[model samples]
Target: MSCGMFDESRDVIEYHPIPLWITPFFFAGSYMKKRIGKTSIAEHKKTLLPSDEVPNYFSQNNLFARLTYLVFWYLYVMLETPRIILYSLKKKPDLFYGYEVYGARVASIAGRILRKPVVTRFQGTPLKINEQRNWNTLYPHGVLGLKSKADAVIMANDGTHGDAILERLGAPKEKIFFWHNGIDINFVINTQHGEELEKRYDLNKKTVLLSVSKLVLWKRVDRAVWALSALKTDYGVNNAFLFVVGDGTERAYIESLAVKYDVSDSIHFAGAVPHEKLWTYFTLADIFVILQDVGNLSNQVFEALSFGLPIVSLDDGSTTGILKNQYNALLIKKQNIETDVPRALAMLIKNKKMREGLASRAKETFASSVCTWEERMEREQKLLNTLINNEHKTSY
Candidate 1:
């Protein structure tokens, strides 16, 4: 939305998700059989969005939950697809841009029904999205069908990441675009929250280990908590403190793991930190950790890079070619993650010199390699404008 290339109210009709029901126990995603319609501008932008506030009530990896989710989603798409077609007919917008799996499917169906062009973006690695548990929105064959229908498909990568999934999906080579996710580098470099975080957490005296991600199985935040336990038990690193910086359906499971591992006292759940103030935790940490299962080099990883914290992550398919081990990050193999993650954390905790060295390398690498949000905005504007202006353009 910061890309403000087009006025949202007139030119675009994007999805703006909001809670259908909110309480201490049941959240928006948990309110099944609830879908409301609203149009409003996000606080940061003046763009009007067609809010399809739907219930995403299930986030569990179980046979019953999956079946229930399918039922709810089918009901939602069946009801919502007509409204989208009606809106498209009334507005007659030039393009239909659908985000992620479900949105893309809905848009593709509606676009086909109306004989309109559609553009869809793959938010994560599309092939094995099924393994993400409740985070999975579509099956491989379902996405394969969506890819074939879309006029253009956007993948969030700098072209260094492989395109085997696209090849497997049979997405048109000519219609593919590579636009990696970028960050506000200057904001992170310039912002400082001072000593309050340090004083509150006593970070100066502790080996502060930070993991910033939604508490999801795909994100593998539970691995970080287990590593914290291993540090104290196996390595005698009792002063280590782990700060987990996001919450989700997997939060209770992770909390249970912390208790099971006996690291609850040393673990601090910061929940969801506001974007503007998130720098405080970033700046107050000694080492950063994330074990993204599908090798998604996401925003939190970029934020960790900007903070110049030594990172501990997996050297997987996506990150292998991008993040070099030791020079920029300390990467471990996935086969032995339970053992390797904890051992890697222990190594970082014991060696302060190594931590400082890796931190310096990370900052230097980020300065040269990463693109800022402004640059991303420019690229997106150019591509989208071309897509809109030319009705006969072949490939970009």
Candidate 2:
């Protein structure tokens, strides 16, 4: 049977998205001790909920994952589908909720069996109708037009992308809503330092630039190497060093790029740090930079803002203008990254006053515009309660 904490007081059962559980870019601990039963469940004023993870693939092992999926995922789903059904039968949850495709599909199957409402949070880009849905074989329901099975669908990150906006994902227009995940920063979460990291790196003396993300091909971290080189070659800012925080398939290429650009000495390759401890690097950074394929506004963006670091990122309208030039961040156009990244980094490094100004504004923007997890989840809870009530009336 599925594992979850039943809240009799609230009449709700939640499969809380285990903190970046599947995000290999963050930490392997998401799959390790960070999971529920392993860690002590702290009491919350609100009801405590149980969470679980169903990993799709390993980080930095995409191609290998695809090849092994035939052998692994089939057996994986085979075992899970039955447990999900049995869990639903045993728990008789008022409703079922899911995190991503795998969890969502399993929840859908359980809901169909129990005739309960299912709400799913789907963040990945939508697949075309004609495109083969590989996940079809993984679950019992085939998962074609899964949105139809879900009572409510939550699309991550503003949901304005072509697939989501055009309804190409086949989600009923009415069932859809948008909610970006919120950060948990009340008073600058990282007030401590990583001692070993401090001894190993010359972060205190050097002008530190930080970039945290999966070093995937699409993220284009190679361009950050180019900027790091520019800080030396073009701008002649020899004291500056770029600390890259992540590990992925592109790690080799990025390492090679650092050597190619002759800035190998100036870049620190701190492979994936534990999520809770990442704030150590954040507190140590002077500026945050990224050349993401999508617009800026990932978890790192908020973390940087909270840490009061000025941001230099590329925006492609994918996030619908979450960042503004010179107001909260320095936004680079996709077409101008070759010029924009170096220029932005150079400018921030040269002018401490402006850098501090932007950093201040970024912190202010986060305080004024952003919602914490408590606030966002409160809204989500209200929605779930409303949906349950509406379905109850409909049944009557």
Q: Which regions of candidate 2 are displaced past 4 Å?
A: 1-87, 126-148, 158-166, 186-205, 392-396
Give lDDT: candidate 1, residue 260. Answer: 81
TM-score of 2: 0.73
Best-fitting candidate, measured by lDDT? 1
Q: For residues 1-396, could you state the per-residue lDDT of candidate 2 as single tens digits? A: 122322335676656332243245224333432342121222320221111111222222233233343333344345555776776676667777766655665666666667766776666443322334544433223233244357777766632252353255466667776666688875433444556655666666777888898976556677778788877777788888888999996698779878877998888898898777688788778998866654356777877888788888766665454567887678777777667678888888889999999988888877876788898889888877776666452210
Best model per TM-score: 1
Looking at model 1, the pairs that clash are 29-56, 29-57, 30-57
- What is the C-alpha local distance difference test score of candidate 2? 0.63
TM-score, cand. 1: 0.74
Q: Residue-pair clashes per candidate, as listed?
A: 3, 0
